[model samples]
Target: MISEPDLVKYLPDCQFGVNSATRLRFDFRNSGSGERVRAPWYRPLCRQDFLRPRTAAMEYPLGRHNFLRSNNLEEMQDVLGRIMCPHRLSYLDKPEPLDAVINSFDLGNLVLNYVQYGVPIAVDPGATGDFYALQIPLYGNALVRSGGKTIISTPEIMAVTDPEAPLYMELERSTKLLLVRADWDFANRVLRDLTGGLLPWKLRFDLGLDVSAGRQCQWFTEVVNLVRRADVGGGMLKGPMWVPQLEESMVARLIQLHAHRYSELLATPAMPASQRVFGQVVDKIEAMPEQLHTEGSLASEFDVSSRSLRSAFQRYLETSLFGKLWHVRLHRAHLDLLWATPEETTVPAVAERWGLWEPLFTQRYGENYGETPEQTLRR
Candidate 1:
């Protein structure tokens, strides 16, 4: 007798956007205020889902860059430790030949990874490190243990892990995962800025993603895909300009949309900053966007603390100081793109003039005006 294909068994070939590979890994919705859901690790897939023949010899793209064709557990562990994170990989089943793949991208303080394993395994990251992680399962599922809590990470639900804690996971034979990591400082700053300096305590996210209505998962996915597309086209990751903007937007969105210890505080309406403080920072950003304009430098320039400056930007502009600077540079680049002649100006040249790269410029332009720099130049 044949059984129906469970959700994990089959993936549509044409779903991901990149020519190589890009797919949403986590979409786990919170169960309830205090409810915990445990999903099974193993789900049988239909034979038709096999790419070639589901034989002992098969290769899968790691993420977007690497591939795993060999089943050697040591090689897999070594590659993972070097490229993504360090962990102990152990087979749960009878070590019946392993097959796996991994792909990763680093953007500013945020790291994204896509991984899949063909055999049941146990993963124990002794300590998660100084970064927060959100693990989403694209195909199949896994059981994650962290902070004395066990949560099922599946397609409809994601696991949120605290960086200061240790975590363990049990993977199914066909488990594929998408993981997002944010630096502690980056995440902390985003929360503080978003709340207009009213965050009086540490911020902690719930173990599960808040997929409940109005979550910013869709927005986060768009940003992730946009970066992937730019990288695939080439030349975007060459500079630091566009990366920080994308990273800040991504982090800020996560804080605003997800359910966490500070969710209620973030949702509280923020008080506006004083006009005097706002004007001072805007002047500095407009006058010298190309300068090493960190919050510390800007605060020192205007005789204000970094916290004060962040609050001013958050309260008045609803963005970080760097975010405003990004906008200023972006606008200048847009004008230059319009004035540039195709014979003398290239996308890279124009982008470099504003500290951005060609691919980023193209992506940003398309996003803002629904046209690319090349298209804009043609007209």
Candidate 2:
């Protein structure tokens, strides 16, 4: 478990204070050669193939916790124009020292930023040449305009803009924004992989997202915050071990919550378990309980939607495919335990053979069977 202080070392020019007092600054200029640009903000982030070094003196924050206090509009325009979308900034009132605080986490393909744009400004509209940009204001309000349609973003609502569209914004005072930048190709790939390779030629997202009250919205918010905190706390995302899974989860939630051109295809009612594809899925799971399986992986194997597969299992088996898989593996592990000679086998060894590695497996197995694996072996 990495502490908040432990994360300080990863930030540039970090200083220590008492008890959780950690000051970190990430001057984007200092990180030379385009090695790392904090997403959505750093202009040259996406199209590295067409990289052009900027002569403008731009300084941006990529921080664990830091303040972006700047009054110079040129510097702000340069940073915002390059990193995010190119736009002309207009002050509704004299921009009184833009004091935006940032706590950002970079997860390779996606960048999560908890930023408060502390001043009011009007941004002119032009096509934001990026993949996907999602902005959720935590407080106050912002009017977002795109495709001649306007939506006022508040705490209960979020704006998910397509990269190809022209976007304009009028930010009110103290409007804190949580911005998420995801790669367009990576997002579509996940969707195609999830839906078994059936997708439209072009994917377009609805500009506004209603997250006022719903289970899906709650789950999406929870995971986003969890990932943000985890990244800030322990650098959990810095390693490859859990990054792929976490990124997929985040992207999956976005696809679910936002309405896009192919939303109906994804939301199509699932087929019955009596379907041949569903039966084949169950057969595969039963025959190879130890094989690697996930909702996406299994759906792809049977050339069906993961949602449909899940619904089929729920309708017929009264358990999720994942739940059924767990029981099958457990039953297999039990058989292995029974057959193993006392000197040759241990509970952990048996568990490992069935893809139930210790620590977690022991607890889960105990919960299901009301006894530890060793106790089961003794029987």
Candidate 3:
């Protein structure tokens, strides 16, 4: 077993309190075998402010004895935007190996605990535990490996590890990490619903590190600044409702951006044969409004049998081409009826412009908008 003195030397600056202290007490009870080990631990409490322009002061009490034993960053450009200043204070009498344990907490509950590993730390995985761990690597990369795969994470990339699965990470250099142990049920459900059910089975974020001078880079910077100013100690519920909503939206957008990048990589070229034929047919119909404008003419132009063109259009735009055309024309006619000058814009003129020369326009318009075209024009 590790000794307490060695652990104290490895401890980092105490952010919780100046006088906060840690001491170890032991109790040995005889079970059938020999003796059972028990230790009574108490952690001191402290408070701090985030000090940002946009948000107010957030304060919370925490103890080192309860740090990771209880519950739970990115790039200059990426880093500047994503994290607020994080502080941890601990008081322990001796050194001991940190063990994996089952723990749970509310999703928005704030804590003042920090982990300072003298060497790189590696975490082993377990079953679906109570808490969701949000790992922010402040300094060097934290290499996470699981399920036969590995990811090197830095301040640019943020990792949310599920306590349910086995997980471990090694750091090349000494590293500082912010571990937030949040409720799994709430975090999972909110994330799933907000993402439209497109997120992966696990939670992780790769905040790309390319912080060149650009609009995206600037936006990243703003996000980090916001975090820096945010009151981490203030529980999420006490804050404005918009705070959690905004956070969820930002996470969703980040996922979408990465998904799009992956999609572009997988996209293949369009078929030449299909493109050439479809291009010529669509072009002619769009150019000469007389011949190729109608459904029959469109079918002929495409050299397709009856209903084939409609099927092709459905495949391309998820709607019959003729129906889409009609919709567009009707929408334009409605707009003209609504906004046109009284004298210049009449029911008949609008109908003619939309290829609805007869009473069919009036009937359809009435069905769709609950009023006749003439009534719309008059209004």
Candidate 4:
């Protein structure tokens, strides 16, 4: 891989420089026309039509990731602004010059944001919020002044914003950032399980997570890479099944990697009754894979709220209520196929017995078993 410095020599046609070791300054002007042209951000899948929502599945193929491309500041208020809480986005240098594009993907408990204003900009919000935000600069740096601490977020070091702090962020004109926003309630639930109950103190992190080296970089890189891969266009990426696993992994990795006040307690968290219930629930599913199980059904049987039950599964099992059930059902189908009477059973019959059908059944079966049900039966 080429070092960041050698970029200038390799890219002779473009102007590039590092300002303050934070700003990745690059200016590319249109040669044919005297107007400025923004670089491409969205993949070819949705790049063809910016008007269409990238999340729509049937209307277009694999609306892989949500995308927004606009020069309008007011428009961002409705899209990025809403999710980020009440905030004001403004151009720092010029009032009218703005080329902002944002792509956000949801992972149940957390959200991954890829944002770029393509101009010097500031995001202003209230004094306190209910989420933890980890900002990593992919292209350029951003200065984060939050909770009475000022941190310059670069590629090597990430800036962490806790829920208790007010947030003010300014990005240089040449910057693209990836931010992971973890919801307060969801985070608390995970932490609570780790500590057996909500501690008297709130979860807080140091202003910066030094990902320049060590385990911090490894974990952060792993989570970010997973997000990038998940954002790719595909039928499976759109499935509801993968969400819980993604959420659990994101929260778990952040908890394990990031330096926080509860690091000691979280490191050796106690397993509670709820965790036992989650395990027992797993056993129940395996014992009777043929039974139809839903979150509400499982929660009722276990004497816990559906939300708590979900949390238990997400925290301890790293999967959802339905996700585990689906896995068990798939496993049962495979077993049936493995010992099938070739003359008496068909792929469709085996699949149907386990509430599976069609090409999707074949697809899911192949993915889970490394072969089609037909192949398993043939053997």
Best by TM-score: 1
TM-scores for the candidates: 0.67, 0.60, 0.34, 0.64
lDDT-wise, the better of 2 and 3 is 2
Over 10-97, each residue of candidate 3 has an lDDT whose tens digit, in order, gives 1111122222134222222222254444422112211122221121111111221221332111112122112212222221324333
Off by over 4 Å in 4: 1-64, 234-238, 269-282, 288-330, 335-371, 377-379
User: Which candidate leads the pack in lDDT?
Assistant: 4
- Candidate 1 lands at a TM-score of 0.67
lDDT of each: 0.60, 0.59, 0.39, 0.62
**lDDT tens digits by residue: candidate 4, 112-140:** 78777768889887554778887877667
Clashes of 4: 0
lDDT of 1 by residue, 246-350 (tens): 565566667767777787765665444468867977987898787656654455456554556666776777676655765688788777778877887877777
Candidate 1's C-alpha runs over 4 A off are 1-64, 67-69, 196-202, 234-238, 291-327, 330-347, 355-379
In model 3, how many backbone clashes occur?
22
RMSD of 4: 10.7
Query: Which candidate would rank higher by TM-score, 1 or 3?
Result: 1
